[model samples]
Target: MEHLQPSLTIDFAQLSEAGRKDENQDTVGARFPEGPALATKGVAIAIADGVSSSSAARQASQTAVTAILTDYYATPDTWRTGQSASRVIHSINRYLWSQSQNNVRQEGYLTTLSLLVLKGDKLFTFHVGDSRIYRLRAGQLEQLTRDHNQRIDKNTTYLSRALGADLSLEIDMESLETERGDIYLLSTDGLHDFIDHRTLTEKLQSSSDLEALTHQLHQLALANGSQDNISVQIARVDDIGTPSESDAITVLSRLPFAPLLKTGQTLDGLTVEKILHESERSQVYLVKTVDGTPLVMKTPSVNYEDDAAYIERFVRESWIGSRLANRHVVRVVEPPQTRTCLYYLTEYIAGPTLTQVINERAPLPVSDAVELAEQLVMGIRALHRKDTLHQDLKPDNVVVGAQGICLVDFGSCWVAGIEEMASPIAADKILGTLNYSAPEYRYGGPTGQRSDQFSLAVLMYEMLTGKHPFGEAYGKAMSLPQFQKIKYRSALQFNPLVPVWMDRALEKALSIQPGQRYEVLSEWLQDLKRPNPNWLTNRHKPIMERHPEKVWKGLAFAGWAVAAGLLVFIATR
Candidate 1:
């Protein structure tokens, strides 16, 4: 019941001054969150220096610093640090650029920004313009950012890259290993230009107090006659915290795996009503709390008790499921009592799996199939929005009930944020069902949202026609050549009710190459809902190709009539 403690900790301090300038155009800020956020998002420190020539330089600098500190935390915890920071920075750039363009005087809003995030055992840096980030460790000082200014002369230089400088912005990003005693310094050109790296490194090494060090750096820059606004920020890593994998294992291994349960068996105050499902990796039991509320309890199989990677994944499945809240996704819930073993609970759904529905109702009505597809897409989009991919999207993983289609089973889910962390265990490259997996998984090609799209398309094909788009050969095809030899069969071949546009959409989504698939899931869903303008030509195809079964049936009837007439004529003669 204890919260995940903050594993990453740091000593941080910052200062900004106008120096000789009339107004301070430099801004600095930092956020050291407590508890899970600190462990997930880490500590954020940022410094921004406004362009002296711009009319709104002060506002630009303040906005840049404030936005990074605030918006970075607002991003999904499942997003990689670079992904979250880049998206926030890009949005800030757009806002500043649009504001400048709307001004009557055509004045610009521009600033140089440097952000340093201490996450886990790593440091991530994002930089633009002349602002710099330096790391001091073991008496060695290294500049981690390159100035974006172009030198025109000895004393004159122009910034080639800065926030709001143009419609598009290019920023530098880098990641490096961090040690407990590592000291990082972020400063604007006002400070770095006046003070040399040797002086900065010496000061950082000599000082133990980061607060006093920041002020010392600022005053030193001012004494050096910095003509512009000066700002300085420092962070000394107190702890890189436990490595992610180790922390994960420690938390996941706290309790032994729950023993197999049967009806009327109780553990952690939840009594098992029945065995719901069992597999090589886990067991799912329908359980009830003392209040009689039904829930699904998933426990790892004893076979995997010694498997560190499997145990980590099993724990993370519960972690991931608890975070995702969507009508079409099964909800993982906290147990009424503190868990005494390695198992998680979810709200029980009284419905059959999609596999059962398909088996009982093959060739479902077109409208019914489309409706399920729409709900499935919603659930898949929810996962994608969190930077998580439902790599194993299949009928067996989906449950259809009165509430709608709910996606279950996250053992194969891939999270971008988690993937960024270093792990001692190698992840399984192929986790999804091969029959429903995208071709990229087999070919060692890149996979992303599009990969999920391919899996969803296969599910859709099965729902509508009770068949795979590429037939049974698809599940067995492992090589590019084998896949290339397989052709997509029309859904209408089995289900005459499928519209041509819908079939075309399925074909595109099921493309052997990931690039050929829909760029987004919504586009494919739109095509499935209505006739695509581009596919209107499909309706004009010859009847033989469009309705081959009907054509063959008609030919058979005509031949039978002719044969009957010839027989009667020969008998009469």
Candidate 2:
């Protein structure tokens, strides 16, 4: 069947046969979920090759192929393809392993599994054992998976990893962008070992039909004297659709923004209660539906009416908020049934921004600061787990509610999967605040989860000390040297209540170089609660090393004292 959409189209086919074998022990299958599932889950294809040594090996192949096709669709639609497919593969491996244990000879039901999942414009690959998945594009064949086999000699080898081989499975996974006219080929060893690259390239160049290509591959394998069952699957991509942000920009460009909202004014079924915030990029308003449910409406700023990048980011903010459903992250509300203008709604959080809390309540208690920092880390962890980075994490972007802290702005968030797709936005521009931004950002270095950790550490230090680690020195810095010159004062200088170990933790997170910073958010979070013995033992730093200014003043004071004592002795003599 053909999977067709306005922007994306794909066709797939498969052929399998027992070659020089009494029974066919290989299984191959493909599935494309329809409707919403099609959009969310997309398509999946699986191939499994059963071992010849076992009696019920065919059962392992059939079970793995069938389970992946059926259970992958049963997974939560919101899940990313890699996560969903891996979960299903794990379950299938366990079931096959258990069946082997119940057998009389304990000769396991062994099989090799390779799976490919196409979602949006990206392909997710999962592999275990010797089966292979390959991509043929532009007359070149690229093997996307590694073989799990141990070679004893040049002529002999054995499968090192396979389904039913062990209770625990390590499946290799990778994701890549799919281009138009890309052809993906999957096969067992029977076909790949027999078909040479030249012949495969010739066949692919000659045929346009996926079904015929698969059939030709199987026939070639048989003609080349393959002893095992031959199986092959082919998928051809015709087109890829515009991503959500691009689509949103197209839809919103035709619609104009509603006039500035005032208290008691109504727009898009939401009654304006108050103006929440306003900036050059966007405006936020406290609004309520007719049912009295509170909501926060965010509208694009009139200043960015002609700016495509700004508008895309504004729309992407809502898209990101909708995908993440954590208590610490702000939730995006569905659009009203009827809308009069371009704006998005979010659950109205009743609390002050962390900036407000820090301003009015400067130098918060150590426990209180730790508590808020912990909550913010939870939100950062949520983003990181999804392969996303909140490039702009600061006190202003967080809300301090009674329930706890919630991270608010996603305009500067970077999602890994989405970033791989083509977009009008460019990466040269830096997207973060000055002082809290990691030093690498100022120098145009790549940012990742560690970059967010640096920003989080800046926030934690600011909460305790009421000052930025680098202060105003980081503002408008041009070069890496300038960033390296900025001094990071110990948090204890401002708040003695902050333990020495806590300051050291902040010190590492506040490293000028991204590489020197804490690699993971959890490491810094753990350090805040309990002191690391290594940190404690190494805390004895010289005054010049710890506080340069203090060291100079102490030296000047000693000089003045020595001069005054000598002058008194001279006068007495």
Candidate 3:
């Protein structure tokens, strides 16, 4: 009772005659320890109903809840707010299902559940069986989680995707945005079937006393004829207040793991010479080895040892990038699996950002801009040939050195066909910049080479014209008319000097419908070879450094040393 008191925000009033066939099942249905580690904005709740036909349901429910909470808290840092909580729950479901199947007596021993995980302003809810999730916002009640019971002709009693009943599950992922004053309630069907949303909302609306409110809600569920076990996990969003500046540890240099990693200190034979960008993830530096070869060492921020998610992404991106043998994409060396808690290494290129290059040389001559586009397109095409999608393509991600444009940061790129791909920016899922994201990606679907192409087209337009096709106005460009009518075409009206073919090429690439646009990468190739280069001019002043060939030479040498040594050893053997 005390555990429920501090964690939840509800008041249960007095109970009357409730609709239940048995007297033993009249009380609230919850299995929890008195002491639970408090979460910032999440509720660790577990619930189960004892099957009328089997005695194993009680033990099954308790074991199921305990296992779920154990794994939920044990989650690595890589499992953060953006990931699907349903995936986590579904994992639990599989465990519970397998456990229930091993014993014959517990054959039908199963409990329905609805679990809620709230971290910060993000809410992830997963429900199996008849349990539910309720949200009371703006004084209006909304039942967010749906029930699985499938009663024949009438649609009431039987259900699908419950534990111990089947092997796999089709879980519904109910994700929502939360504010400071929102109220969330998670309970079983016993509580929901009896209490209506309007009545629940009225009792749960922000009140001076929550204990009294909780008692009131409890009494009402009992009064409504609740059969089976009843339980509630109510969470009220409270302001934890902001962290002070002193709370933040400033990172301006390489993160040292042990005694010291200072300037001139060499790691893995590479001397730490200069610091690049330092942040919460890693301390990037321009490091050189004993042989006078320079490389970029991304030493993990001290935060990495504390945050598992950052480590996962850093390791994943580094490993994936290293296997790729392409000129345009920055190469990562060393096996990612061998990476320590301290740092990962990558090939360094001294060049200006495409964003900077375009800034200085906007409105490039038709021929040169086309050449840049050709390289960019071919680089992307090579990556695609390997079935990789550069989910995040922007001026920042593209490096313009002496050789050509080098795409940096495979952090958001993925193996093309995975379901849970990382987004490029902070807005929505299926990640990429808001101005460049495809309509399908913003919704919900596996974004492939085509979607990446759309982003490339946007960046191409920006590179040529020094302006975004959608610009800042596209944030509000969610309306159908804004997308279908007033986008890239208007840019042509702004600069009539842009050829009709170039304008139309950009328009076609930026098409709202993916299939309607260029169905082939060859289309981008065609655009790159087009005669009019003013579409994206390359004549801006000196944005990039004078030397790009130096980097190409270094990479070439690194490759030969490894290859020549292999050949010599083989010949000797």
lDDT (Cα atoms) of all candidates against the true structure: 0.88, 0.83, 0.60
Q: Which rank order by TM-score, best down to worst?
A: 1, 2, 3
Model 2 has an lDDT value of 0.83
RMSD to the true structure for each prediction, in A, is: 7.0, 5.9, 19.9
**Per-residue C-alpha lDDT of model 2 across residues 15-72, encoded as one tens digit per residue:** 8898889999999999876654555666788999998788877999999999999998
Higher TM-score: candidate 1 or 3?
A: 1
**Count of clashing residue pairs in every prediction:** 0, 0, 34
Model 1 alpha-carbon miss at residue 73, Å:
1.5
Once model 2 is optimally superposed onto the true structure by TM-score, how far is the C-alpha of residue 320 displaced, in angstroms? 1.7
Clashes of 1: 0
Give stretches of model 3 more than 4 Å off.
1-52, 72-83, 151-156, 196-198, 206-208, 223-227, 240-295, 298-573
lDDT of 1 by residue, 1-573 (tens): 112344676788888888898999899899988766776778899999999899899999999999999999999888889999999999999999998999999889999999998877778999998999999889999999999989899989899899997878887999889998898888888889999878987899987988898888888888898888888888888876665556656766789989988899999999999998898878999999999999999999999887778887887888899889999999999999987899999999899999999999988888999999999999999999999999999999999999899999899999987776545555755459988989878877888999999999988998898988997888888888888999999998998889888999999999998999999999999999998988766465888878999999999999999999999999999
For model 3 the local lDDT of residue 451 reads 84
- lDDT by residue (436-504, candidate 3, tens digit) is 666556555445678877887777676667787876776556545566655554445545566666776
Worst 10 residues of 3 by lDDT: 1-10
Which lDDT value does model 2 have at 277? Answer: 88
TM-score of every candidate: 0.85, 0.83, 0.46
Model 2 CA deviation exceeding 4 Å by range: 1-6, 19-22, 33-43, 66-107, 117-124, 140-146, 151-156, 167-179, 240-249, 252-256, 424-430, 541-573
Lowest lDDT block of 10, candidate 1: 1-10
